[model samples]
Target: MIRLDYPIVIEPAPEEEGGGYRARVPDLPGCISDGETRQEAVSNIQQAIMAWLAEARNLGWSVPSA
Candidate 1:
């Protein structure tokens, strides 16, 4: 299993982006999560990271190393 401490960025969503907090892994393109609260957004991002890694593994993509 690939273990890495990838950087995570969480920011408040803009009005046009829908009001909520959004978390994203800067190193992983298209890996993003959003929620009503900071905690929710963070939790969702954790799941997103796992799913992203799983998909990458399934497709034989190289997992990024921190």
Candidate 2:
């Protein structure tokens, strides 16, 4: 199992973009997620972070630290 912590950037999603919230892990390029609420966005991003790490590991990519 691999565990890593990365800083997240959360911002309000644009109306045309679904009007929820967007969360992204800056340390992991292209790792992003969205949800209807801030808390939800955070939760979703946490899951996304795990998935990102898992994929990175499988692909033998370098994982960045927080």
Per-model clash counts, in order, read: 0, 0
Candidate 1 global TM-score? 0.86
- Model 2 Cα lDDT, one tens digit per residue, 1-66: 555467889999999877999999888999999999999999999999899888988999987866
In the range 1-66, model 1's lDDT, one tens digit per residue, is 656478989999997988889999999889999999999998898889999998998999998986
Query: After superposing candidate 2, which stretches have Cα over 4 Å from the reference?
Result: 1-4
Clash pairs for candidate 2: none
lDDT over C-alpha atoms for residue 8 of model 2:
84
Candidate 1 backbone collisions, by pair = none
Q: State which candidate has the highest lDDT.
A: 1
Cα-based lDDT at residue 10, candidate 1: 97
| Top candidate by TM-score | 2
* TM-scores of all candidate predictions against the true structure: 0.86, 0.90
